[model samples]
Target chain A: MSGPDLLVLATVATLAGSGIYLLLERSLTRIVLGVVLIGNGANLFILLSGGVTGRPPIRGLFGSEGISDPLPQVMILTAIVITLALTAFLLSLSHRAMRLTGDDEVRDDEEDRRVIARVERELARHRVREEVERMRRIHAEEGFRAGLRARLGLRGTVRRERRELRRRMREEWERQMAADDPEGGMDTTMGEDSP
Target chain B: MNNVLVPLPVVLPLLAAGLRLALAQRLVRVQRGISVAVLAAVVVIAAVLVYQTDHYGPQTMHPGGWPAPIAVMLVVDRLAALILLISGVITLCVLIYAIGQGASDNDESTPLTIFHPSFLVLLAGVADAFMAGDLFNLYVAFEMLLTASYVLITLGGTPARVRAGMTYVVVGILSSVILLIGVALCYAATGTLTLAQLAVRLADLPPDVRLVLQLTLLVAFGIKAAVFPLSAWLPDSYPTTPAPITAVFAGLLTKVGVYAIIRVQTLLFPGEALTELLLVAAACTMLVGILGAVSQTDIKRTLSFTLVSHIGYMMFGIALASRAGIAGAIFYVAHHITVQTTLFLVAGLVERRGGSTSMDRLGGLARVSPLVAVLFFIPAMNLSGIPPLSGFLGKLWLLRAGVQEGTWPAYALVGVALLTSLLTLYTMCHLWNRAFWGDRGKLPERGQIIEGRRGLSGTGIVATAAPGTMVGTAAALIVFATAFTVAAGPMAGYIDRAATELLDRRAYLTAVLP
Candidate 1:
């Protein structure tokens, strides 16, 4: 029935805030640290939920009326154990990752990278096709629109548009080749972009 | 019998896991036998629990005869029992498949000693989550299963598994922490963690406070359930693991989250109005998930995305919040767990015989292995909700429930669900054409597909013929999925009654507290 301690609440907030910030980091070690902090914060918050009574929860050692709620403490202990297990597991996993790749930063999955590259490559091809289609349309309509464009003095704009399309098609083809780079040197690109 | 069976699902596997670990690398065959035996026993117990809970009522068991408000209580209601039975069947079959795979490949990457123990522990955690009558115990159950999954996922410690496991672990931890915070808040508000007790007390709180508590719990479960944008990690993480591990995780892990959402939404906040929010989440999850699935070239990743997509169907059913809707949700969960697991197992076969799960590299599997083709075809069609399949029946139930609800959002969700089904069908056709029907030698892009991507180097894979046990196990699950269609009448009836029992919170309250 009593109010929760403000100090405890503030501490929980700080720990959780920092923990989450660190959690958003790409480094596995930092994420591990973040998880640990957040876990402790959660434990503290749960403890606070039981209401702050400095008295022991033991019924006989302390008057029953003044005894703390034991359930949250018990739950916190369980949480601590689970968090500990997870921490150890994460550390070992990070160590393995570090050993393999010389750093523990979580890398983008190869399959996901492939999927993205495929998307980019497909988009590039689509753009090239669209440009080619536009060129074909321009060619097909040349007999009709050429004289109108000449009279309108719009030939420059048409020529400019065609030149731009050709440039875009060439650029897209280059990008498609880069994305299709067989070794998937995705490392040079996606390593920095991975979440 | 209820008392004996209720805790056994959690306890039996846990105890066997300890014994298996003690046996260690020595007596590896014996260890495998123990896991199969333990999971089989759990499946039987779950089946009986399902029948008992349905016939009698929700059955509750408290540890050490402690008081209701604080003690860890396990309840096997109709929903829990049904999910437990289905997951038990899944884990058992997947275990058999894993054993067959391990026996054949002699793959050292997934050291059998760790695999069986981790798998059994995951089984126990799943059972406990299903039967957990208290919120805190549910948290523990989530941790237990997830930790086991963390091990299973990173089994080989390969680079791909590690990278994938990192995202999966981080996301999982984030959800678990949120779930813990939710549990703490619930306890703070209600002065107890027992769900039945909370069901009574939560109603008395201010509406705003209740809404806050409800949204908090929903977000936590939504992440676990892989509701979008929360679903981004699933397809990224799931496909990197070994076949059996991925099958079990895909089939049961996300569904566990869905099960939790169903439990809390129905039991903890029955009258609370979050239908609009849930409907939006469901629609986005369906659309985005299927779109992602359709775009994936890898068979496993596509199936993983579809797994996320179909979860939206269950969510749609839950959002409807009617008896039919709830029934549909339960039925969909049952059907999905079986079908999804079967599909993943088949994907494993595709990876083995066809030399890759990537469609670009895999071809002519129908000719290479007719059995694998048939296996994949059945579940793939079922996943797309083919007319005669259980998936279609489950979707029809939801669509009917949505129309019955007769709201704009409900109509939107129904349309989204229909579109998702079609998209799912499209993915299946794409998979069939690229992986099964097309000849590998004739693939135009076969030379250009990423050859150096570590795992997807299907171009030069030394193909391994799948063992009979693995194929037969997958086939058994396919038949089981098919059986759901044949018995859709009885299954629907059972689910309908279960839904009623769930909505009538008074029954759960009285049964647990009496």
Candidate 2:
């Protein structure tokens, strides 16, 4: 590599590096400057690629040996025009951005944040609703079971009381009968009891 | 047909845009008529080019009759013609949709005077990029389109649009600069900027140098194509633009980047040096992009993510580096342009009828406008890769190619692709449930809700019904998407031929250099 080549390479590196660094900034002006730096770096790269130092390509001007590649120059020219146009666009956009937000910095998308929050809230509401529905079903089942147990307990109590009354009635009847026919009843009762 | 028709696709639009600008002081209706007629002519020319290229092989033209290697040339190969035809039709439909919107609303917010000319310029740029036979010409074509898009994206000059436009312009400029550097590096290595010449010259270079050049170009084009890591600028930027603008950008712009990548990967660097890397990128692009879509609550934002995700499918095809894979990618590109554009148009109509594009604020559109719902349904399903749609056919071809490639990464990508499709469906269904099937009574009363710039001011203004032309235009795109499926056999055959020619470098070299 020669002197001009080394310088061109260094320039490309510095410009591209700083351009990328600036592009990462939140400020719109810095971003535009980044674009400009990158554009210039690209132009220099194209120029360097055309060869280190050469005279302009004119038909008979100083022989064709050292004449720079005209193609890269043309490309650089077109690139410069494009960059200028984009810079103009960026400037206008920066103006508009500043006007809208009262700043030249890029603002985060408020709608996106709000939408995400809203979606989270919606999901939470859905989960809560499902949870409440599940609890309600459990509560209904528990109440039904309690009501059934109470009814079953009452029926058990009524049956026991009825059995006791019947037993008493039978005993009273037996007593009366026993009184009426003591000897026969006593022998028969004893035989029945033994069987 | 004369080779002169080769440049007409690009030239006619530029001329019409110039004419429209001159006639700006005239009636808006007149300007609209001229724009439509011009784009319709472009569509016809594109169709004829497709037929010519398919029958007779690639067509080439030198603008000033200079020699092939010295003069700038336009090559209308099968791939270029096919993309041109599809984009022509899409731009026409979008123009009609915008005109309908403009006419119906008669709102001063969106100035028709600026839009018509800018849109025409955008068309010209797209055509130029598609047909460009040189790397520098492709860069210029990109700049043409990007400049025009800057104008269109910030049409209303709203604060939100300005912010989005800032990101878009910055990203676009940065990518172009990178591309310029790549072009310069290629030129520095090889003494030419013409792609065919570079294709011939680049193969002789050492593997290390070629790898560097290839990576440089891929990084530049990847940013443009919105491939995963380089794609964050897309979702934020695209959704804030006006509907037709977003539709066209989603349809054509990123695809142009994909087209450039295809051209270079097949023509300039024909080996598999970067295959695994690209495959990894493709897989990541698919999974990560769709995941982003799933997280978005806005319809436009979700669709933007889907746009990025599907670029992965194209990259997958490109990565396979086989005839079938490239062909499948071509077919996928065509299918995606139509389906994605159609979906965005429908979203626009939904915004018009529902008074908001936010899904939570939208509901019962199915009942309010059955036509809008139907319009949205067809394209949404098509986008989600439902059976019998072009999306399904494209994905199927890509997957089959991947399986035939039979690598672990390819197979893994197949699984990822299927999963992406399912996730895409989930996103679409989520949108459907929130925007169409939810309770109508829960919605705030319909009103003229200006978006982005204004707060939700429901001043008791009733939302107007969508104009028939807008719905018809969107339906026409849906019909085209369906037609893509119906004609899948022939379309696939065409794409296969295109891919074959693209892979066989001698065909393009001979066509141009001869």
Candidate 3:
């Protein structure tokens, strides 16, 4: 990349970094600024992607010294207009929001946020249950295979060893089941023996 | 045959509004009559253009005989013509109502007069948006509508109205800006601004870049259409406007956004990502919007949420990226514009007779004005997807398309849609029970609440006119909506044809550039 391309890239990188930082801030104005900066960064990236070099690509300005790719420049113009309109509107929205709610802080709608959190928690719970069930099935299969080998006379296993294996497998299954349940433990397990 | 007619819908309104502003010295009736005549003419012309386009395919008229690639191309297809037709017809009804309702005073009329022209310009903007052949032209069309809408939303400049309008305007402007940026990026990526040409060239770019371009366009359109997360601005802002204006905006503005989404999806980037994003957006939008509607106490606000919720249904088909899906979406658009507008119009009538739009302030209206109740019932049922109504048919078609897709997401979306439909009825029932029935105890005395500025001067007359015209205008709109219900079959076929035309861009390309 040449001088201008490098400059554009640096500008884009800085804008992107700053934009992300601002977005991470809690204030609505900073968030808006972040969005605007991100947009500018996107524009710069587009400019670099066009891969054009030399003079600005306007008609009748520079005839023979060759032309920079006009495509990205044209695209940038449209981007600029759109960005300007969006930023201005966002600024006004920020002002209106401040006036109406009496704050520029990014206040959340309590009801909506509560609903979303509930939904997320439910989904996460379902995922955890599925994962625990899979682990239990794997453990049961491994124990059953080991017993089959012993029954086929491949190893000399005492009664104590068989009992211990059974107990361990049962314990693992119980642990898996309990892991899936968030409310302490399953009620069905309350009257069960230790084994 | 000049593309001039394409701009007429927008220009006539703009010019009339400007004239109304300039001719402040003129009689109020004269100004009103002139505005009415102008809008009526626009409606007639739009109807004719729609009919003609039906028979002749899409019409492309270039202003000043300028060729594409350099000059602006005004395109009028069946889709645009239909929207223009809707806008024109609604405007006529609203104007009649405006006249019958009469002015509140000189200051109100001055602002009100601005409404006539602004409304006309809004039509023009819709036309321009629908007919725009290039990306930049689309931006301009969007600007035209946004500017006009800002004026309409805060027409009388009430503090609440102003605050609401400010949010609306800001959101609208931001969306436009986003769209413009996308357009610019598009032009830079591909040396052409024409949509058809971009459609062809965009296909050749790297997948990543193309994805970005498609997403940029989608985000911009999505914001305008108020899909899911981007739709927060609509509920508060839309309900703050007067009933008629709210009716028109609710019916027309977001649909324009839907229209653009359709155009771009069908024409430029026909991809899985765009389609998937649209589907996800549709699902979320429906669930959230209806849920919001369910919780609202104000009838206008409730309807506004429903409007957002129903938009997802239309997006359902567009997201499907199939002929049947798009057709269903097209039919849904027409059905929704009429039904939604009529609902808002009735809301205005209810507010007038019952003293407030809040359910808490009003009750037993069905017992008092059975006519208004009957008028509101059909569309309410239709909106909730009752069988044998246009809403039901539109939903049925969309559901069939979803089932045909048989994808897990699509199936889930169908379920969501059905649930949303049920909940929609639940909310509408709440409105009906609270507004149309319930104990007659302590509802604000009829006509006593005085619309604040538009209160009656003497014996239910305001500003030297009676409200009979307002009622008549609303009744006409209701009748038109009923006709749409009656003609659902033919309307569906037309929508299918329009969808086919949109997907097959050969004609659209040849007409505009050739």
Candidate 4:
């Protein structure tokens, strides 16, 4: 009962590694398999606790001194029965999941998904609003610059700047229209929509 | 001390579960009556065990009359009896509520009959867990409860429940596996599974090995307890169940995990072996859980997240590992079980009257059902720790304990604990404003009420008023929870004594071993 059993340990590590890999997958069927694998690995762990091998814990076979403890084996049997019940339940659940959704991939909790989508949508709208604001600011600065140029008597340059500003503003307006999905968001399009 | 009561809590329910299943095909009233009687008897037994353990120090009973460290050992001390008493009452009330709901509903949307056996088994599991004297028995207790929970949660196998139950069952069994591994390591290190024996033997192990064992057990229990990093499964899974089932699960299941942590800390790895580790975890659980609560739109999910958040307070108490801290944690646990279950039950009523649990959809519930409004208000305020309530008292004691300990991490936790409380209040206030105070929004069109109580779940609707049994049960629990404030003085003293015996360990160890 002293030193560890390398073979059982190695098997457990392997089963657990593969089991965890499957466990991380979203598919219910795979997760069930992962549970089985890891469950067996855990069973081996319990068995290993009783030591690598033993003088059969037979009551009369040998003096009790040399006989390996039977508690861990008894413990594993109980664990296996539990694992069996859980596995059966999981299998039925996966079947139900498959029948309901046509696949057993776990769906996000609908509220969690709703929250994520709403947040993402709001963030996208915010970015779009900022871009339009930046564009409008540039347009205002351009108008101011074009007015100064016209006053300074550069008609061609002023006309060109004004045309360019108008074209740029038109493009920004189109983008803002698509992005303004929420109520009243489209109302904010008035400033940028002006020719 | 009359130790015979110890086994009754675990055994009576199991025997009744079998009888319930046997009678499942026959009269529903008899089945319900038997289930109720069994749980009522359990409450009386639990009460007796409480007085006996408080007076006699501790009591132990062996199944099959075998001695401890051999046949299954069940021990009742102040800690187990206190929790057992509350659990017995909660389960009884929830069962009554379920029966009331099922009897009146004509639709078969849920199998009302399936609840009888499973609920009894679940009761046995919870009782067995609180009294389990060995780690393996504790594991068995966990499996028993979890197996029943999986059934209860997925009762109707609706698309939503099936989806949620998959996650619930998978995460649950995975935790069991990890727990088994931890048990294996403990057995290998100490060559025994009894709690008292491990307490004695573990102290002599190398600190490194001891830490490994401690960390292993923590990770397993932490997942079950739904601590910060491992709590995502709770809100997602819990809200999808029928309300009564959700109430019991919310009130008792995570607390079982917390109870195990208490046992592990006090008996197995006593002293401040991982105070800093548990403190950081507690702080994170509080902050992360409350933040999750604030962001949820559905009241059920909101309460589910809050359930996770509140567990942090217990963790904070246990992490301090002081007498006052443990006492505070125990008090918080008792207060929380009643309040959390009450809140969920109220949420169920909100769904019935207000048409939806979604905050945006529910409005003017105060005017719609004054009784429901008041029912919801008390537990919600108590949960957020308003003054003259049990939640506030529990928090005050825990934070005081943390301050008295006076480590930097303890200070950080106290600060985090206060912040979490405020945010919880903020979330509750925001919920009140939207659901009860504002203009009545569009009530769900008759066709739009989404829940199916398995019978009239979504159909020929009954009166918007909650049924008498449901309302009475919820009101009874809320009153029970509020009464804690009135009894705070004596209750605190009792748990303080329980904490002393817990930290001392000798009273428990010799009681089981000698």
Q: Which candidate has the top score in TM-score?
A: 4
TM-score of each: 0.88, 0.87, 0.78, 0.89
Query: What does candidate 1's lDDT look like per residue over A77-117, in tens digits?
Result: 99999889898988898987776556667776555456555
For model 2, residues B1-514, the per-residue Cα lDDT tens digits are: 2298999988888989899888766676677788899999999999999999999888988997788898888988999999999999999999899878766665423356778888989989999999898999999999999899999887656555676788888889988998999999999899899999999898899989999999999999999999988998999889876678899999999999999999999999997438899999999999989998898778998999999999999999999989989999999999999999999988888877776677867888888878889999989999889999999999999999999999898899999999999999999999998899867734444555433222111111136677899889998998899998788888888999999999987778888876
Error of 4 at A122 (Å): 1.9
Indicate whether candidate 3 or candidate 4 has the larger DockQ: 4
lDDT of 3 by residue, A57-135 (tens): 7778888577887766665676677667767755765665455445565544323433554565566556556555655
What are the per-residue Cα lDDT tens digits for candidate 3 across B1-514? Answer: 4555676776677778788778875776788777888888888889888888889878777676766655667778888888778877886887676555545322443455566777777877887898888887898788778877887876654444544665576567557656766875787688778887888788889988888888888889889899998999898788767677898889889999999988888888765436677788899999999999998877998999999999999999998988889888888888888889889988877767775677877788888778888878888998998987888888999999999998998998999999999999999999999888987634455435343323211123122212566667777877887777788777777777887887777777776655
Q: Could you give candidate 1's per-residue lDDT for residues B1-514 as a string of tens digits? A: 1376789999998999899877666777677778888899988998898889888988888876887666779988999999999999999999899888776655423356688888999999999999899898899999999999998888757566777888898889989999999999998888988899999999899998898899889899999999987888898889877778889999999999999999999999997648998899999999999998888888988999999999999999998889999999999999999999999998887776765677867788787678889999999999888889999999999999999999999998988999999999999999899888867533223223333222222122235567899899999999899899999898888899899988988778988886
Off by over 4 Å in 3: A9-195, B1-4, B104-108, B271-273, B446-466
Cα deviation of A17, candidate 4, in Å: 1.3
Q: Candidate 1, after superposition: displacement of residue B191 in Å?
A: 0.4
lDDT of 4 by residue, B128-197 (tens): 9999889999999999999999998887666667767888898899889989999999999999998988
Question: Which pairs clash in the backbone of model 1?
Answer: none
Runs with alpha carbons beyond 4 Å of true place in candidate 4: A1-4, A62-65, A127-195, B107-110, B444-463
Q: Show the lowest summed lDDT stretch of 10 residues, model 2 chain B.
A: B452-461
Q: Which candidate ranks first by DockQ, i.e. highest?
A: 1
**TM-score of candidate 3 chain B vs. the reference:** 0.94
After TM-score superposition, the amount by which residue B165's alpha carbon in candidate 2 deviates from its true location, in angstroms, is: 1.3
Fraction of true A-B contacts recovered by candidate 3: 0.06
